[model samples]
Target: MSSLDILIFIAYGLVILLVGNFLHRSKEKENSSSNYFFASNSLPWYLIGTSIIAANISAEQFIGMSGSGYAIGLGIATYEWIAALILIVVAKYFLPILIKNEIYTMPQFMAYRYDNRIKTILAVFWIALFVLVNITSILYLGALTIKILLDIPLIWAIVGLAVFTLLYSVFNGLKAIASTDIIQVFFLVSGGLMTTYLALNATSDGNGIIEGFKIIANEAPEKLHMIIKSSDPNFTYLPGWRAIFGGIWIAGIYYFGANQYIIQKALGAKNLREAQRGMAFAGFLKVLIPLIVVVPGIAAFVLDAKIDTPDGAYPWLLNTFIPSGFKGFIFAALIAAIVSSLSAIINSTSTIFTMDIYKNFFHKTASEKQLVKTGRLSGVLAMIIAASVAPLLGRVEQAFQFIQEFTGMLSPGITAIFILGLFWKKTTSNAAFFGIIISLPASIFLKFVFPAMPFLDKMLCAFLFTSFFMVVWSLLEGRMKTYPKAINVDKRMFKTDRVFNMVSIGIFIMLLALYIVFW
Candidate 1:
């Protein structure tokens, strides 16, 4: 990279810091717990939407998913495209119940539906997961990209990213995170597309974007197929038919619906309409993510780029093809993805700890000011812990699969419990608790005893087992203990806004067309 490239990168970092601090200062009151945690419930639909995408599309997508695209072809894009469909379902069916309840975190919702014990258990689990798995994986992957592209040391890269996140986000909380995400998303999308365009241009010998696409289509047609065949080696990971109809929904609902970090953005919206609209907007953007993140990997393959590991594809493209000044802009985009996700997880971790555990148990009478302080402290501690653990993930062969395997083991049970709790009036607290307990053993059994099962199939089996257990246990417990009254959510609350309904239809149609074209 030229000196001009280094200067551009430095300037990008400074601009983000300035923008985040400016947003933090713009908020009138900073002491209120609600304002600190929920961005004062003032974010509009556009900010909420862009923030959701920014938070979700981190190093994981750029590094991990692009790696999958390099190794597995366009079949890897199923995750992103299908998520566009899931986002619509979640926006329509899930967000309404959450907004009606007015909860701060998913665990808090669990408490409202079940008991404080359940809430506390899950809260601790999530806090640990956020630090250990989510933050650590992101930091590791981001550092790997930096090391590959710019020859930066892994530890310094991790520290630089962590310090940048803390400087802009820790004190001001979600307001800074959400507000900066608007700008972050712009850089993320623009840089991602620029990389894709440049890569495609290189592949087609400077024939331009459209002709480049045609060249890739004709030269490497296999990479454009969206569906993996059962006979294909990649089927074990994707499991064509099953991916569309089975375990993907379990994982998707858990992430989009019950995950605290993802849902917190929706919770911060000014109204249900805004939240729903924001989510629909996110769904639409999800459709475009593959174009930016996945296509470049395919282009790398078509150009016959020499990459030893799949994760090297994106960085290989940047270092080889992107010019100096433009390289800095793309590097800024990568940093934007990393920082936005880190700030989000940090803010959500603090929100869960402060509201669910600290306030509920340790300091039941804590004032708003005290709670806000605890939140800041929690964010800092979580960041430190995650940074410490990030370097350890260097030993993992595939950082993305390492995350998915462990997270998949737990998602089935959590999804079963949440879905049952929401819809099944007969579901008892004890049943929910035991159902969660059974899922872990079930997942382990499937993993070791039936080693041939696909990971998604294992999730499906565990989900079915847990769901059945919850129903049976709930019925059996009813004979001995009194069941709590069912949650009284008004049916009318599920109604979709007219604009959201139309937009959702358009997204679904687009997804259908993409699948049919690629299939």
Candidate 2:
């Protein structure tokens, strides 16, 4: 990129930091643990929705998923499209229970439903995972983008991204993170669409988006199919029909429903209605994500761009097709995606550690001011560790697939525990603990023992196995003398505003149409 592009990128970062700091300072009077971690439970629907998407659609989606799109075609979009459905389910079913509990963290919810032992165990696990895996991977991918596009050293790029994220997020906490996410989402979507448009126009030699579509269809129709046959050696990761009706939901529900960082925005909403509405809004955005992240890869394919690796597809498109000033804008958008995610997971890592581990175990009598201080310190420490470890992840071929395969092992068991705990009063704490403990081993056994079985199918098998053990163990233990106060199981709690309902239906219909057209 030219010097002008670098200036534009720097300008974007300054704007975000200023906006976030301004908003955070505006709320200085309400300094408390609740304010720091949950945004004082005052976020409106639009902020919640945009923050959710901003936190979710990071380097993984832009870099890794786009790479998959280049390598495996539109079938890779099954993850994005299916996540829309999962978000709807999470909003209607999961948010009500969580909001009613007035819980700050997922592990806290586990503690309430079962025991502190469970909460402490999961809390430690999530903190370690976030620092070691989530933050590290995001930083690595983001730095990789800058290194490739700007000829910068990878270590310097990693440090730059980490410092930029910490500037906006570490001091003010979730309030700052959510407020800045609004602007981040704007850049993320608009810049992404701009890149897509340019790539498509490039494919068609400046004719039009419609012409570009026709070129891709005429040249490589196979890339447009949403479904792939199992026998096709090229697309084994997405094993045909199972992509629709199999282990994907286990992964999806765990992410949208059970994950701390993704659901923290919802938990911070002004009201349950706003949270539900925000999730529905996010679901709507999910439908559009693939257009920005995935279609450019297909554009690269149709234009016959020379890319040595699948992950190179997006960077190649940006370097080749985007103009100088516009390239800076898109680069800023890419940084926005990366920083938004980094800020989010960093906040959550601090949240889990502060509320679940530190407050619970270290200082039960700690004041609200002290709690906030602990959270900030934890956020800095987590970022330092992640930045230190991120460069080591460069060896992985497809960072996206690596994340999915590893996370899938834990998701199935966690999903099972939550599903039963929410709906089944008979489920004993022992059963839930056992389910969580057995998931990884079962997933690994299936992966290595039956090497031919697809990963999604393996996830399904592990989920079922964990679930069976839960039910059998619960039945053997008999009903607890007293169960956790059953979550407000009333159907009224699940009701949505009329606008949300209408938009949800519209999103569902659009998804159906896409599947029918692409099937």
Candidate 3:
């Protein structure tokens, strides 16, 4: 790497740390649980929107997404596009309930709908998931990607990202995270687009964007196809359209709507209105991610990038496609993305642990100051656990698959509880409680005993079984004592304000155009 490149990378890292520390220091005394955990419920729709997308679409999207596209053409886009549709459901239906109830974490919602026991159990489950799946898998994969590109040691990268994230989350809390995310997101988008454009130009050899497509069309026609054939090695093509539409759709809804890491940003909304707008904003962002992450892989294939493993496509491009000085900036952006995601997890994990577990179960009368302090302590502790465990995740071949395969187990169980708990007033707490428990064994059976079925199919079976049992138990044993009184729905919350909608509409149109152009 050139001296200029190294300078750029250093500049990027320094800038992020400075900005994050600045935010943390600025808000030190605003250290209430709401401020630390939810940005004092003051984030506008735009910040909430960008932060959610940035948090969810970290190195996993940068690394694993292109790999999936390389391995399976556009078939992997099911994750992004399906999530777009699910965001609509969440914004329209679920956001109101969560915002109205003032849920600090996903488990807090469980406590409200069911009981403290279920809340504590789910909180512990979530904390474990964060360390095992999120901090370990996502952080490890992200660090590995950086290590490969920059020739830094993987362990150092993990520690660097973890410590940087821990500093802000431990001291400043979610306000710092959400605020820094506003800046980090700009780099994430700019860096992704920069790499994509350069890759396309290199593939076309200055022939222009049109020739990039021609090169791809002539060189590897299979890479351009959206539909996968049964013989496709990348993903299973069996079980017909049911797997694609029904099974995948159900999973997508569960993931985007109920997943803690993704939805926690929205849960911290300033109000019902901001939360709804934030969901719409994130939905629009998801639509553009394919353009940045997937399009580059197509360019890589056309460029004949050493494609032994699809996972290598992204890192290879980062090394060869970008110029040196700019490479540092992009590297900085990647680190920023990693840090942003890590801080979000640390914050939410602390929230769940402190409120749902520590206070509710361990210290019933803990003061507000004590709760906030405990949250900070939990954040630090969670960071230590995540950093320690992250090294184990370095072996994951594809970041996306590792996340989905593991989180799929927990997501479905939680989704069932939330869906029935929120929408069905008659859903007895007992039923919701048992419903989540039963899903585990059923999912385990399907995963270990019957690998022949697509994982989605197994999830569907488990979900249906749990849903069936919940309904039967609700009817036979008893109903909820009373329909929980409805929280006032803010009409202003559901309405899309003018400022974000204008840009969101443009992105939506662009997304539609891409679908048509690629279709």
Query: Which candidate leads in lDDT?
Result: 2
Global Cα lDDT for candidate 3: 0.75
Once fitted onto the true fold, the runs of candidate 1 whose alpha carbons sit more than 4 angstroms away are 25-28, 396-404, 479-482
Report the Cα lDDT for candidate 1. 0.87
* Model 3 residue pairs with clashes: 273-493
> Lowest-lDDT window of 10 residues in candidate 3?
479-488
Q: Estimate each model's TM-score.
A: 0.97, 0.97, 0.90
lDDT (tens digit, per residue) of candidate 2 on 361-380 = 89999988889899999999
List residue ranges in candidate 2 displaced over 4 A: 26-30, 395-404, 479-488
RMSD in order of candidates: 1.7, 1.8, 3.1
Weakest lDDT window of 10 consecutive positions for candidate 2: 479-488
Q: Write candidate 1's Cα lDDT for 1-519 as tens digits.
A: 778888988998999999888877433477789888998787788888998898899998998778888878888888888888888888887888878877769898889989977898899989988998999888889988888777889999899889989999998878778888988999999999999999989987898989888998898888888878888888888888788778888999999898887888988999999999999999999999999999998888888878898888898898899998999999999999999999889999999999998987899999888998999999999999999988877776587466658778989999998988877777889888888888999999999998877788889999999999988898898864446745666778789879999999999899889989997
Q: Give all candidates' CA lDDT scores.
A: 0.87, 0.88, 0.75
Residue 420 displacement (Å), model 3: 1.0
Candidate 3 lDDT over 1-519, as tens digits, reads 678878887777677678777876443455577677777778878888898887887778888788876766665665686577677668777777777677667777777788777877777888888866777766788888877876898889788777777766677777678878888888888988888778877888877767877787788777765545556565453243444565675687676676677787887777777777887888888887887788787777667788678878888888887887888777777776777888787877888888778887789999767888898888888877777877766565476465657667666677777788877766777777888888878888888888877776777777777888888888776634444532345556556557546655665576566656654
Better of 2 and 3 by lDDT: 2
